[model samples]
Target chain A: MIRFDRVSKRYPPGVDALSDISFEVAEREMVLVSGHSGAGKSTLLKLIAAVEKSTGGAVLVGGQNVSGLARAALPYLRRRIGMVFQDQKLLFDRNAFENVMLPLSITGFPRREAAQRVRAALDKVGLSSREKALPVMLSGGEQQRLAIARAVVGRPKLLLADEPTAHLDADTAADVARIFKEFNHVGVTVLIATYAGDLFPGARRLQLEHGKLLP
Target chain B: MTAWLAQHGDAVRLAMRRLASAPVNSLLYLLAIGVALALPAGGQMLLANALSLAGTTSAVPHISVFMAANADRGMAAEIESRLKKRGDIKRVQFLPREETLARMKANPGLRDVIEALAANPFPDAFVLAVADERPEAMERLAVELRQLPRVEHVQLDSAWVRRLDALLQLGRTAVLVLGVLLSAGLIAISFSIIRMQVLTHRTEIEVSGLLGATDGFIRRPFLYYGLLLGLGGGIVAWLLVGAAALWLRAPLGELVRLYDLTLVLQTPGTRDSALLLAFAAGLGWLGAIISLQQHLRKS
Candidate 1:
């Protein structure tokens, strides 16, 4: 579970990324954060993940106030919430399988279990056969799918996607959306931030205008 | 603990893997590290040799006992007996008046004067050898030996001992200064090199940070990189110092034998080698930590 209670992030130069935001995602909800470029989409995801500090108010995930989490516990907190970047962010030196296995490995999964889970996640993203291929060898859509596999491989309780469908075609975007839907169906909470219209259908949409959440 | 290490192990493993992938570069760094370590190691070998040579050959412990002018030959002989029975005394030789006159009798320049003298004109004396090898012990034994009736004076043969001790002390100081300066230079070199790498890889590190990698996860590989470089450097330094010692070992051994000394150079002992390895790793770790502080805040 993820909750934000009147969370506001103001930069030093008087720019507010997220202003007085209050929202929550339940156990298996698929919530689309629909906003244009600077509607605090990434900031909101960062707050939930404890990647950035909030200026005022609190962001809670799994009953731990991330705003109040100790620095030492931040890593453990991050281990539970998976984040998929718009960019693949794959290590060029590593193959697709290794890339997908990064999260599980970082979170201390056993090798055999990590391999099995990585295989399953890659299969879900339609990258089962290309696990050994490097990011440079994979197409844009394949790389984006690899990113999704990496995020989901650890079986995080919360999945936060920041424009994960950016580089894919309409057909490929729909395919990725189905992968997200399948993950949500399996009881993983999914919150996707997207400016890509008609990408994820039948999802509860929360719009953001400027720094304020649209009612 | 197992889980944390399992998560972070990739950074260390990857760093080493990269080294294996670039064998030539790795060798180059190793060579640099080795050269840095050899200097003080060789200095240590030099000082060890210099000390044994100076201590044994230069200073031979000896004590001198003088008799009172009024002391008769019988009383001086009694004193000699007392000195000989002491456990600290190694050996004693006495010069009685008649023997002293005889020794003067043998001197060609003093023979005329000795024959013309109305008196024996010489008090009896004893020379002592102390069982103690060190200067301080020999001095104490000499003072105690002079306490006999008719023993008017005592001398500890310690002039050469003092000189050698000073020389040895000076040599050690030089070695210490050289070692410290060299170690500091190597650490600085490592720090700058790692800093350069951090600057070059700035964008890559930033990306890793933004993608939810923890600060420590990003720091892990760099730590390995620092450690490997330092260790490789230390090994190189060890080899270089060993080769130089080997090259000079026979010639130096022969030169020492010419001085009638059994001086030997110590190979950098196990303790020294271990310290060098640890030193290398510590220096590298410090450098990487510096780089982390300067960067990695964003990611």
Candidate 2:
């Protein structure tokens, strides 16, 4: 669940990343933020995750004002919401299984349970066979799938992904979109930021241009 | 509790694996720490032995009151009687000049020197074991004994003990200073090592942070790495000091034999070894914490 109240973000030298952005997503809802490159889709998702703070107005997630949250409290907020960055921030040295195991490790999940969950998540993302392969050894689609497995392994209530299928073939992108839809079908709130709105049709869409939200 | 322990165990294992990945670098760091620590630890061991020797030689303080060379046995007897009457004097033994000369002549090196003298140059003396061993009290008693009639000089035998004790104190202070400086060096080494590790793992750390890893979680492995380095160094230092003590035992025993002082070079005992390990580990942990704080703040 996320709510943004007239949120505005300005970078240095007076560049507006997001301007007068106000939107709300109900629990268990799937929403797509569609925007052109450098059109503030990433900034909106980052504000919801508290990865970046708004220059003005408040961004609320699960009824908590993340903008006013203390630094120590940020981790708790983040742990409840899984994030997939555009760059696919997977640890290269770790195998696919180990990369997926990171979130559960951070939460101190029991080793046996964490292993099981990681396997199940990998299976869901179609990455079960490449569990032992390092990120560098995996194909682009496999790496994207591995990143998704990692994001969903902890079963976070809310998932935010930025350009999850940017470099994938249409078929692989469709598979990735299907995995997100599957998670959303199970009552997980999902917000995806992408320029390719066609990949996720029939989902509620918020379009942004020049840092302004379009109705 | 099990989960908490499991988390810590995981962290420790990760740290060990990272260290193992760079065996040569890790071994070199440990050796540097060991050599730095051993210098002070060895100095402390020698100082302990010296203090022990001093303790054995000066268990009881004695003052020797000598009669003037021209004075006779009657004057010595009188001085002995007066010394015995004092409450501070525990016991007094009269040493006649003839007995002193005889004892000197018994020494093989002094025999020829004594035979060269025309008459016994030895003076009659009273050896007093004093009740109080304090330096001021002993000096005061010695001054009092010197003022007695026909007394040539009063020697406080504990003066050499005091000097030896002072020298031992200085040695202890020097060892403490060395230990402190080396500890700083150890801490700096840990800091630098951890800083490099953090940099190498920069991407992993950033990913972990984004994945909701706490500060403690991010810091745990690095802390354990530093701790292991220090612990390994402590073990190495203990071995070095123990080996040195063993190697020097025979030669040191022979050296002390010439001085008629029996000294055995004892290796660091269990408690000392534990303390060394704990101190080194603490320093390493401190360095790791500081490095993490600076890196985290900057990032």
What overall lDDT goes with each candidate model? Answer: 0.79, 0.90
Candidate that scores best on DockQ: 2
The residue-by-residue lDDT of candidate 2 on B11-59, one tens digit each, is 9999999999999999999999899889998898888788778777755
Docking class of 1: acceptable
Residue-level lDDT tens digits of model 2 in A48-160: 87889999999999989999889898888889988888999999878999999999888899999999999999999988898999999998888888888898998999999
Which pairs of residues clash in candidate 2, taking residues 3 or more apart in a chain or in different chains?
none
Residue clash pairs of candidate 1 = B33-B233, B34-B233, B34-B236, B34-B237
Poorly placed runs, candidate 2 (over 4 Å): B112-119
Per-residue lDDT for A170 in model 2?
Answer: 94
Return the TM-score for each candidate structure.
Answer: 0.83, 0.96
Model 1 chain B poorest ten-residue lDDT run:
B203-212
Chain B TM-score against the true chain B, each candidate: 0.72, 0.92
Q: What is the DockQ for all candidates, taken in turn? A: 0.35, 0.84
Best candidate per lDDT, number?
A: 2
Shift in Å, residue B28, candidate 1: 3.8
lDDT tens readout by residue for model 1, B64-176: 78898788878877887788788988899887778889998899999999899888877888877778768778877776766778788887777667877887788788878
